[model samples]
Target: MNQNAEYSAVNDAVRGQFLRRTWAMITPYWRSEEKGRAWLLLAALIGLSLFSVAISVWINHWYKDFYNALEKKDTAAFWQLIGYFGAIAAVAILGAVYRLYLTQMLTIRWRAWLTEKHFARWLADKNYYQLEQGGYTDNPDQRISEDLNNFTSNTLGLGLGLLRNIVSLVSFSIILWGVSGSIEVFGFTIPGYMFWCALVYAGIGSWITHLIGRRLIGLSNQQQRFEADLRFSMVRVRENAESIALYNGVPNENQRLSARFGKVWRNFWDIMKVSKRLTFFTAGYEQIAIIFPFIVAAPRYFAGKIELGELMQINSAFGNVQGNFSWFISAYADLASWRATSDRLLSFHQAMSENEQRAPAIDVRPEGERLVVNDLGMDLADGRHLLTDADMTVEPGQRVMLSGRSGSGKSTLLRAMGHLWPAGHGSIRLPAARYLFLPQKPYLPIGTLKAALSYPQADSVYPPERYAQVLETCRLPHLVGRLDEANHWQRMLSPGEQQRLAFARALLFAPQWLYMDEATSAMDEEDEATLYQALIDELPGLSIVSVGHRSSLKRFHGRHVRIEGGRLQEQLVS
Candidate 1:
């Protein structure tokens, strides 16, 4: 399908799902522990909105009396009407203030609730990891943070605005019908001519407005994506500043950022062009509408068929009715944005749901006393076999090393054994005990040195002395004094130091089974030997499975294996 066709399909699907899910998404919060506050706030908002509408109707009638008193030159009656206007204005202002405050309160609460809901789904069952690995969606961060905010606010704003307009339309249309009398056009006398005139006028404007601005929906969606891509590119630069600076990649990075921004810039120009055209038509439509009622009602007054008060009232009522009818025209831009945001959020939610429900390709279970693999097979995403019918087992407390040429799927095999690789079919039974997997580049969140060392666990899980001891044992004695200091430890520490920190983390956790995929590749032979020896000394029963090519690692493992031709071959290690 074409791009616009695909977008429309997705947009329709989202709208269908949104209608189905809106109640489901909102019902819970009202029925939740905070139901009392939720319902109370909702009722107050509704009450204030109804009161505001009532105020509009009252002022509509006030227009008639005030203008009649003015035309009659009655000072006392005019002052009385002036005092009445003050009362109406005060009540309208008070209702508006409280209505806005309540709307904001509900918006934030609803957004928070929905954000937590989406976050839970995104993080559950390693959905985040799978989404990233599969490249199933884009800019999930933008969807969760910004799109959700827009969704809640626009949903409320458009919904309440529609309700108010509909009520105003009905109330004013009735008043207009009663006041407009009749008009003779083409030998046909039409009753309630002003009401019909406003209806036809607004109907034509809405149709033309839609025709002129339909492209904006797609443009808005593209604009958001381009903006997000540009923002993500900058974030990547910030994250990899150290590496980029070392490579002197400022020019390259700038070019990449500029290209992404170029998309944003170009897409926004399309949006602006469309918006400018839409504004031209809508501005003319509204300006004409202002004079339309006066022209329609003036004929009756000039013929002395109605007083000035009645003519003014006719104009007021007609304006309200026409404005209500033009609601679609006024809100078209917001509708476009709202539709785009909903489409993104729905797609993100669908991706997570699909990932969660998909049948697992690898059957990894934690049931065996030893780590066992039986009739295991793995494939890359392109259907290329990496390993086939592989069977292996490691007894408790046994250390094994896997060696192979690059692209032999050694790391992929380790990932499958760790139950992370999804493109695999295997029955791998792991020991029902704590295990730790360390890759070459350990992840160190920016925080205190102590927290980085004890990551995937709280900093307080181990005693302070134990933390210091592990750091010193891992040859990181220099870091002992800086345990409590907070910094970007990943950038602050060298590659070797980060690997050492991973070993320190292993020591602190004391997992029974440890998997290392080139975990010590960054350190020299001497430092590697020292950390491996430290592990063996510190945790005597620790089962080590190391993937590396270094000859020095031979002394650390009891058994050695090689991956070749998609099979495991036992290698003799001295």
Candidate 2:
């Protein structure tokens, strides 16, 4: 083997390792609790798959007799064979239809189960939050939705197809062997092992096809990654298109997109090059298969030992065997992408599971009416300290405000209380994890204003009258009429309107403890003060812990706290 051949061997090793890891990520979903139904569906699918192969066997025989009828010039036999052909074709079509129906059922059921399992895992224990916080993976949305769909589809299709082809190979090999007779070479008669010759021929063809097409697996993987990245970039552009265009950075964005798409272009070129070689070999392989059986049986025909029908049957068997061997060549690109998608989904799921299972540093206990922050400390992911030796207390029905500059440990402190800031040290004893946390950018899920206000709870939880009252009190009277108009409220509303809506949500939910982190900054000072007044009036017994910069916003809070100088303290604002 030369250097290129050695490189090819190395590629095989790397591809094998990649596939093993990818498979490890894929196989567990079936053996899960839903495995009963999943397995039943798959078993049915496989049986149909094998049965389809049985049908193909009948078709192979049909082809043999049909062609032989043509060669013998018997009009009656030819006409009768036409009827046989039609009958077999009808059976093949029906088998194909039911096989497709069963396979689709399996695919949809598997995808639904996998999607639910993955979604649950991703949503559990605030794993989605941490993954974004720690920067472990990109495009969780894509991973959960697009990548999972592809994984379900390509994996099942390829696996079932492989199974059918293997059976076809085994079934047809015997037929090819029986039809091929001995040949004379240089006066020393070679043993009649026509089947052995076909086997050797297919073996070499498969090996060469794989050698040529092996790189396509990784290439296809890279292509998917680049394509996903490009899509993510475009989505980002669309989401922030207003900001980009406001700054007149269209040229810059164009350049950025151009750069990202350039990677796609280059990688696609490499794929084309590999696919070109694969096509060349597979094409030649197919053409040779057309004549290979005839050539092998020609000697017997010249010797007046075989009929034309026998030769045709031999050719049909050769076709089936060769087709079985060449399956890898046909599906090489799909296999590559399927493996890539599996790796992505596996890593995503593994990362989500790891985060979900991570032990919380700050243990929250619902003890008395007061929250005790016991020796609470937090660290940056890089091992730098953010909040150190922190301790704070807030009693039930108390209003506490926290003031901190940008990059201070204020938000980290909130995360610590929530048991999400895992890279931290400390214990935060709260009443329960039932507090309402309102961040700076409120998340308004897509729906009616009433539903957005009543998130995590059904819209029916609040009567239409109270919902309207809260919106009017929060200075969002304009949206009072649009309560039933469904749309993407997150994109449609301004920051101030969204912040006010967050306040309305907090008011509606009535959590015992409400944590507001710059939640009302977007509204004007008067409206902000009014919304705080509304909350105090509507929820007099609600405990409020706020993070805010405005001095005008502190009158509603009885106690003030701060996370600064790497410590937590009472600010004592008068």
Candidate 3:
């Protein structure tokens, strides 16, 4: 096949895949446990939509009688038709209002359910971390937050609008066909001439519309990605504002941010150019449609073959039929946006699925009280060995210190033990008990001190007095009384303070097995020794494994293991 044919085939396949993925994303909600309420609300909303179409048909008929009464100068009939119009208008208005209100309600409920489901899937089995490590998807934060929102809202709005247009098309086409009377063309009757005119007009318009606006889908996708990239950059600046300010790096930061925003600006300009062209055609198409019906039906009216009322009704019915056929043209831009959102969401879901199904190179199982590593080997994502033939074991109550040169996989080994690093071959047997892993830099969620202290656990997990005591034991006595004070703790607290706070968490949770990768590096050796001694005293039988360069950490750990020549070796401590 030619290059263009190949591209077309690929595009068609992508579109088909998108539709199937979209259905998979949407069908679960309707078939879920909440299906009963979801279906009932959907049925009611659809009924309201259909009722509005019925009223439109009634009004189309009313046009004939009302205009005829005016033409005949019949005062009583005119007034009676006016009253009928008022009643029909009232019902139509009510139907429209209720339909919109119910649609919004359903949209929010669907969004909530989908958001929760995405959260569960993304967080399950550490899929979020794995996706980041694998580099399988970009800006998962945007996918979960922005793309999901757009998907739920646009899906409901566009899907229901399509349904309403289909109903209107059926209702109005029947009226138009009956009222338009057959046209005698070359001795053969061309029935439903008005309907045929609407179809042909709209068909040509839709074809041109697709030609003009086909690029918008790809552009919209790029626009969203660029916007998200810029936003993420800004967030990174805000998050590291203190560091940037300390280094006086405003100029460099600004240049980086501007570079990211440049992509957004350029893509938005392209979107604007395409949208302007699309709007020109769509607007002209709509404006001409207003008079097109009258121009087509005027001949019969002037010939006295049809009365003024019938002419007016034909115009109204024709507009409705034509508008139904022109749905794609009117909604082209929003459809592009919807397609882009669906594409991002589906890609994110597929990435998560891939990560979930990935076979781990390292197999971790909970077997006994001792943490064991048998013939452990670590490799980078590119298949470069970081560690080879390393083996070690830590029994209950043993304080083991992992000593290694920088970039010798000390931290990576800790990650492997935690089961977060999978690009390696090993059988690690962990203790069947609670365990905690602390990195060099502690994570303090932007919330209350109590919440941060009890992170990954509810505040109610421990009593207020216990939290205060743990804080005091970790040398953060000043923060004990401010348990409920909410702030960005990571920003407010210094590195040493954050490290101390992590110790407070360890003290609170008191896990049976604790792994620390330079967890106390920011602290003074005196304070680090004090905290380690306190942990050993308070949490009896705690199997503590720590990775650090400071010799001060030696006094805390009873066994010393060093990574030498890519293998683990136990050393006798003096």
Candidate 4:
């Protein structure tokens, strides 16, 4: 294919794919458990839309009688037609109001359902973590929160508008055809001349609109991505404000943020330029359309072949038909936006599906009360060996210290044991009891202190006193009184405090197995020693597998293992 042909072919394929993906995203809600309510609301809204169109048709006919009354100087007939118009307007107003109200109701309900579904899939099987690690999707948070909103609102709005326009086209086409009458052209009589004129006019206008504005779709997609990236950057800075301030990286961050915004700015300029062109053509097209029908039908009225009322009705019907046929031209911008949103949502869904279906190289199962790793081999996603033929077992009530050189995959091994690492081949027999994995930096959700502490668990899971006592045990007694106070605890607390809070969570849950990957790295040696002693004192039988470089951790664990030459080996405790 030539370049243009190739581009057209690619565009067609993309459009087809977009349609399929859009249907896939949309059909679920309509066929879901709430299908009955959804379908009823849709049917009601569509009925209102059709009723509104029917009222427009009635008003079109009323125009004929009202104008004829004015032409004939009949005050009584004019008054009667005005009363008829008032009734029609009332029904039309009610229909339009209810239609909009129902459309919004449906948008919210669909958005709620889709958001819940996305959240469930995202959280299930640690999909969010896998996606982040694999780098398969970007800004999933934005996709779920912002893109879903746009998808729901724009899809419903554009879809319903198209439907209404189609109905209006059909209704008004019949009126225009009947009123237009036959016309002689080159010794041949042509039917529905007005309808044909409207169709041709709208068709030419739409063609030009698409030709000029097709680039907007890709630009809009880029704009959304740029906006999401900028937003995510700002959020990252806020989340890491302390570190950024400590490093004095404000200028660097500002530069990065500005770069992201620059893409948005440039893309928006392209959109504005295209929009300006589209508006220029569409405005002229619409303005000409206003007078074109009147100009076309004037000869019939002047020649006494048609009454003034008929000519007026013909103008109204022609405008409706032309407007309906020009729906694409009018809605092109929203179409581009909706398509971008759909693409983002569909990409997110596909990434999640791919991640969900991925087979793990490491098989983790619950077999016995002891944690066991048999013939485990760890590799990076790109197949770089992290560990090979590593085997170890942690019997019940054993404290195992996992130590290694700075990049020897100690944390990766810890992640593998938790079944969060996917690029490793292994069989891990876990205890049939609760286990908690605390990384070097504990994750404290932004919420009430109780929620942050009991994280991945409800605040109601434990009694109020237990929270206070656990906080006291973890040396976070200051937080006990603030359990009910809502705040961003992660930002409020220092790293040492955060790690201590993680220990408090461990104390509250009292998991049978606890995996700590440098979980106390943020604390001083003395404070770390104290926390380990507290763990030992508070939870007598907690099988602790800790990954740390500190020799100070040796006293807390009974056995020592080190990663050497990409293999696990027993290490002597000094």
> What RMSD, rounded to one decimal, does every model reach?
2.2, 4.3, 3.0, 3.2
Q: How do the predictions measure up, each by TM-score?
A: 0.95, 0.92, 0.96, 0.96
The residue-by-residue lDDT of candidate 2 on 172-248, one tens digit each, is: 88777767766667887655366667777888887898889878766775677678889999989988877898899
- CA deviation > 4 Å runs, candidate 2: 1-40, 184-192, 364-367
lDDT of 2 at 540: 70
lDDT of 4 at 555: 92
lDDT of each: 0.90, 0.81, 0.89, 0.88
Global local distance difference test of model 3: 0.89
**Which whole-number lDDT from 0 to 100 does residue 492 have in model 4?**
93
Displacement of the residue 33 alpha carbon in candidate 3, Å = 1.0
Ranking by TM-score: 3, 4, 1, 2
Model 1: how far is 445 from its true place, Å? 1.7
Cand. 4 Cα-lDDT: 0.88
Using TM-score as the measure, the top candidate is: 3
In candidate 3, stretches whose alpha carbon ends up further than 4 angstroms from where it belongs are 1-13
Residue 344 error, candidate 4, Å: 1.1
Indicate the residue-level lDDT of 332 in model 4. 92
Model 1 Cα lDDT, one tens digit per residue, 53-119: 8999999999999999999999999999999999999989999999999999999998898888888
